[model samples]
Target: MELSEMQALARRVRSKYAAMETARYGREWTDEEIMLGFLGDVGDLAKLVQGKAGVRPRDDLDEALAHELADCLWCVFTLADSYGVDLEAAFTSTMAELDGILAAEDTTT
Candidate 1:
């Protein structure tokens, strides 16, 4: 699926979480709370990546790594949506800038 399609799915999942949070906590989570949750997920993702690389032992390491990566992506997409950032455009621009910098360095060397 395209990035936009994935983003739409993330929004739908966020809506589901909102309903669940409202029912459980009396209100949906704040943006800060969401970011904190994302931070936790990123930490988990890092561990899973380590496990995948055999730097740490883990059961079903490959599966765990894939899931954690997806979890991180969901957090990123949701956060971007909340902040009204065009993540795709930002990513493209950042990559282009990096490429240009690397190319210039190659010429100078």
Candidate 2:
């Protein structure tokens, strides 16, 4: 699926989580809480990457890596939605800037 489709699914999932959290904790997670959760997922992804590198030694490493990556991506989409950021546009602009910088450096060298 495309980025927009993925983002739509993320928002739908977030809505479900919001309802669940409100029922359990009387409120859904705040933006900071979302960031913290993303951080935890990032940490998990790092360990899984190490396992992929054969330094951490995990069975079923491929599946774990895919899951963790998806978890991290979900957090990104959720955070972008919460913050009112156009993630696709931002990503494109950032990549374009990087490419320009690299091309400039190549000419200078």
Please identify model 1 stretches exceeding 4 Å from their true place.
Answer: none
Query: Scored by Cα lDDT, where does model 1 land?
Result: 0.92
| Tens digits of per-residue lDDT for model 2, 48-99 | 9899888897888999999999999999999999989999999999999999
- Candidate 2 whole-model C-alpha lDDT, 0 to 1: 0.95
TM-score of each model, paired residue for residue: 0.92, 0.95
Position 39, candidate 1: lDDT:
94
Please give, for residues 50-70, the per-residue lDDT of candidate 1 as tens digits: 776778878788888788889
Backbone clashes counted, model 1: 0
Model 2 TM-score, all chains together: 0.95
Clashing pairs in 2: none
